[model samples]
Target: MDHEDSARFAFLHAAPVIGGAALLKLPPLLGALGDGLRGPLLAGSVAAFVAAYLAPRYLARHFEHRALIPFSIYCSVVGLGSLAYFAVT
Candidate 1:
């Protein structure tokens, strides 16, 4: 996609998370936490948010794109493993 299209896509993807943080999480977190801990909590959450947002972009940029086979295999393995474990139990 072009630059504007990419920006729009990112914004569209991010708006819900950002809006939820502002409207849902932030108010409750601020109210529940004290002044001493709020700064650290907010900073850590921002760091986590940034990492989660950028990690996929970094992986996509640096790695050869393999669509979804690896993920599907992983899910199948986990699902079968869980089924086996439950069956045994």
Candidate 2:
């Protein structure tokens, strides 16, 4: 049941995930546009979105269960850095 729930809920949750990602990324995108770097910034955003979407498929095929380790490390580093910064401030 848990596995079934996860399977069913995973894709269903992607909309909010993508929306939240876009929201979080929008400020830098807007700033880039203001700085007249619109074309490169937009291209980079598209490339990033494509890579994020496709990389999982490749990772699932090659790394299977360990596919998320790198991403987890990245998130952990960012999260800890944010926590430390806030604590120091």
Candidate 3:
């Protein structure tokens, strides 16, 4: 797929997560936390969403010409660590 298709695919995948969090998760969380904390919680959630949305774009530019070896190594370590943890547990 081209760049537009890739972006559309990313947005489609992300929509469900954002929708689920806003519709299914946020209400219960807000209720449990009470009115006093509602503003801060919502603000924090928006900030987190913005950060998550923007971070990849920023990182993509920074790593545009970099080697993928570091990322591959990091993924391997995490995957093995997870496997080990699950096997022991």
lDDT tens readout by residue for model 1, 1-89: 64344544775698688777668766666775555778887898799779867765765553444454687799999999999999999
Over 1-85, each residue of candidate 2 has an lDDT whose tens digit, in order, gives 4433443456447758878988997787677455776777789879977876775555445543444568779999999999999
The worst-scoring run of ten residues by lDDT in candidate 3 lies at 1-10
lDDT of 3 by residue, 1-89 (tens): 64444544676688788877679866776785576878887798889789878766755565556655787899999999999999999
User: What are the per-model C-alpha RMSD values against the true structure?
Assistant: 5.3, 6.0, 3.3
lDDT against true structure, model 1: 0.71
Candidate 1, residue 28: CA error in Å? Answer: 2.5
Lowest lDDT 10-mer window, candidate 2?
Answer: 1-10
**Which sequence of candidate numbers ranks them by lDDT, best first?**
3, 1, 2
Question: What would the TM-scores of all predictions be?
Answer: 0.51, 0.42, 0.68
- Winning model by TM-score: 3
Top lDDT: which candidate number?
Answer: 3
- Candidate 3: residue 37 Cα off by (Å): 2.9
Q: After aligning candidate 1 to the native by TM-score, how far in Å is the CA of 87 from where it should be?
A: 8.7
RMSD of 1: 5.3
Instruction: Count the clashes in each prediction.
Output: 0, 0, 0
Model 1 TM-score, 2 decimals: 0.51
